[model samples]
Target: MTKPIQGFSKLTKEEKIDWIVSNYTHDAESAKIILKRYWNDDEALQNLHDEFIENTITNYYLPLGIAPNFLINGKLYAIPMAIEESSVVAAAGKAAKFWLDRGGFKTTILGTEKIGQVHFMFSGDADKLKSFINSVETKLRSEASDITKNMEKRGGGISKIELRDKTADLDNYYQLHCTFETLDAMGANFINSCLERFAKTFKQEALHFSEFDETEKNIEIVMSILSNYVPNCLVRAEVSCPIDELADNDTDANEFAKKMIQAIEIAKAEPHRAVTHNKGIMNGIDAVILATGNDFRAVEAGAHAYAAKDGKYTSLTDASIENGIFKFWIEIPLAVGTVGGLTSLHPLVKLALEILQKPSAQELMQIVAVAGLAQNFAAVRSLVTTGIQEGHMKMHLLNILNQLGANETEKATLTEHFKKNSATHSAVVEAFENLRKGI
Candidate 1:
């Protein structure tokens, strides 16, 4: 067995790769070749990628695609989406185009309050702890001033601090819950900096407070960090039109609206359907989040938690047809930033923001929410009418063809052929095989 090697990180890049492959990989030479093959040709770009995280090896690339005709708040946009999925961009584009002539999407920023917490354990007089907490709110803000000065100047700073008692959930558990307005930044770093300062001040002040005994003053700080769950940092995107105008060349307008509402209702009432339903919405949201170098994982976590906010996991979207008007909307928590992190650093991210017309953080939130709503609308419209597989499989045809190793001419021919016949893996494979056999 290969034993653990010391100073593995200190080894030369080539030596480290050789050791790792020699010890673990089945084909060491091929593994090395694959790793080196993905490295950027430009030294500067390679260095930039390496600095994004620790122990970097080679850059991993995802395709960057543009979905055009996104009409949001009366402005036209071509959204950049970076994703590996075959049909996400196509689905989003279809939705955007469908809504473009139908009055487009309208968005509203419900709130912009981010949250953080300083968790601690205190086994002392509950009343005394409560009293101390009330007195420290001002001190917490005052002490965190250094950290918040710049943010305050930009009209973003500490909103409030509250002492939350949670001893019923666990023994001696409590939290200093804090809220802030981060303006044009997602402000994870800024919020975290302020939280750490508050934690330090809360602990140190307890050290010399005359009202506390030796054991009582010994408040043990568990952790101080920003929360990904920012329900108050929400955005709403909705599209509305007269029910009569909802018709297509083939589908009836009123029936289509009712079918769409019924589909949403099913998702709201069933967990099994809601998970997949919400995932389809995230398919579009995550693509834009990733394209702009924001945290999609955080957005995913917050959104799913919000979906379950009613004590049961449900759909993030809603649909209704009433009084000759049909409406579809979604209110989602998305704490994205127009500045900071990779937004200012990554070349592609900068370009993506430029393509977005350099929107403010609030504008970006609106756009992301609109993207999610559009994606869900398209998915549900397909699900209720033509069936989802029709368009999805069509979009997935190129992927299947590539997987079957079709060359230029075959791919071109198959691409045209699939438009006439249904595209499926087995069918494509059989056709390719028959073509190979001169059939």
Candidate 2:
């Protein structure tokens, strides 16, 4: 049995790798080679990556691809996507090209308010607690002035604070729900700093409040943190064109519109379908979020929470036919930043944002929303007509070929063959064997 080692993090990078591989890997030398293979050639760049997180390890890489011809708000953008999944970038490009002449995508920023909260246990009377919070709101804001100063100069800071009583749910449970406007940034660290300060000030002041009894004065703060459920930080992206314009060589426009609407409706009503449907939307959103060096996990959390905001998980997108026009749109809460975190640090992230023209936070939000909508359009379009596997499997063919040990020449030939045939795993294996045997 393997035993845990002490001070593992204190070891040098090489020592750490040696310990890990010697203890766990069957072939330690091969494992060491694999780990070291991904390190950057530039020493400075490799050092920068090593400092990104604790217990440094070799960098893991993903393909950074561009989905071109995304026209949003009268401007054309070639969205950079960092993802390993096959067909994602291609599908996005296909959707963008399809909508290029049809008034591409239009987006609107509905709101940009973010949330933070201080959870506490109050054994005092509810009415008194409410009055105390109301009177102490200004003090809470003032105490965080240092943290919010720079943000305020940029026209964003604390928006509001509210006292929420939840004694019924859990005994003596309550929350100091706060809101903020963080312009041009994701605002997680900012919001969290403000919240921690608020928690400190609120607790310190409670001990001296004249209206509070001994029990009320001892307000116990549970935690102070930013919430990843910014329903108010929302953006909408939509595409609309004449119904007949949606027609392609293989599908009728009216029938296509009907089927698309039906597919969306089914997703809206069924959680199973909605989960997969929303995943496709995130496939686009996450790729852009990752490329731009924002927090995709937080954006994902906020989006999924918003989808189930009405008490049922449903589709993040909707479609309809009105006035002889087919419209498809998505309204999602995306809290992303173009100026912080990895945005300025990572080389690829910098390139990705530059490719996007250094958009503001709101502009980034719109672009991400458009990417998601376009991706959904492509996925649903495939689902309702040619079926998803046809395109998905074709894109997945090369992955299978690589796994089956096919060389470049065989890959090229097999790729051509699969273009005219289904690329199922078993079928590819049979064909690969035949190709090697000169069949």
Candidate 3:
């Protein structure tokens, strides 16, 4: 572990995140060390290092602020987020505050299941190969059964198998998608391991097909990959608030609702806008994923794909106002977990989970879904009222001041000047030395 920096405890939350970023190396191992201290988990410290090397994927950190004053299902939560965008945190805070003024958010979960794919390729007869594989369906299930035997005792296991045809390849290839009920655990790793173990059976079955002699016909097994297309296991939440609570300084309740709806429509109409719109929701989702050391990338890819599932890119959140009440709904493919792997080991993740009081996997997903809904509320409010850039530019000025190395007094002066003169980086830098000298 790196030496603990002095004065860390005295810094504000934003400053602490910035300090960690400035001093810590941006790597999985380094993240594990820092998180371990935060969560007090030594095992997570070891596993993070292992997973980083095994996955061969790089880590990117972002500062996503957690808003306070959240009351969901009559429970208060200090939500964590991992995103780089500006308005998300402030917007969520405002939206939550508005809801709190009314009755706060009420949420629920559906269920959780992830898809695993197993592919088989044949050079000779596709029919024979498909038949051969189908004949051993029971045996195949048995092979996959061992992996989930424990899960079965817990009332979760492989639920079904699906087949698809592809004629574009030179050789006939078949794709088998296996769906499993993962309960509270994100079962990607388990599903992949199960399919890999069953590959030998699939290969053995292919060799026995009558159309292709084992010696002559080339039968190869392609990919045994885990998919994020979680159509089965989905969680949803709906929040309602009195329109009077959403009223702003100049806008009436009805006017605010109409403007929010219009802004959301704009986001739904354009792909570029939709990307940012969905990203706002993920800001809330990814933070929890990171805190638990779950696969954030898989969750991200699944969410965006689910967003575009209807062939038109759009926002993940929907809102409507009726009978003097405003309602918001959000549905995302959130394949996260509370137990196993990094969740049990990573320190900061553990700390985050503890701060959250170790919610069940379903409970955790519910929190994330609510966070997404709150974040969307924030974004739409900004777009409808003062314009998104207004709040964003104000916060960005701090980053600009840091880049210019202005002292505390200089920073305050520069912030005021930039607020008045439309602060540009070059303009700030030009006056930076003079302002520092005066300080």
Q: Candidate 3: where are CA atoms >4 Å away?
A: 1-65, 83-87, 123-130, 168-171, 208-219, 412-439
TM-score list, all predictions:
0.97, 0.99, 0.79
Worst 10 residues of 3 by lDDT: 52-61
- Sort the candidates on TM-score, descending order: 2, 1, 3
**C-alpha lDDT of all candidate models, in order:** 0.92, 0.95, 0.73
- In candidate 1, what are the lDDT values of residues 1-439, reduced to their tens digit? 9998998877776787889899999999999999999998999988898889766667788999999999998999999999998888988998898888899999999999999999999999888888898778888888888889999999999998888889999999999999999998999999999989999999999997778899999999999999999999999999999988888889999889989999999999999999999999999999999999999999999999999998999999998877888999999999999899999999999999999999899999999998899889989999999898888888888888788888988988888888888887888898888877878
Q: Which residue pairs in candidate 1 have backbone atoms (N, alpha carbon, C) closer than 3 angstroms, thus clashing?
A: none
- Preferred candidate (TM-score higher): 1 or 2: 2
Residue 230 accuracy (lDDT) in model 1: 93
| Candidates 2 and 3, the one with greater TM-score | 2
lDDT of 3 by residue, 318-342 (tens): 8777887878788887888888877
Lowest-sum lDDT 10-residue window in model 2: 335-344
What is the Cα-based lDDT of residue 72 in candidate 2?
95
Clashes of 3: 4
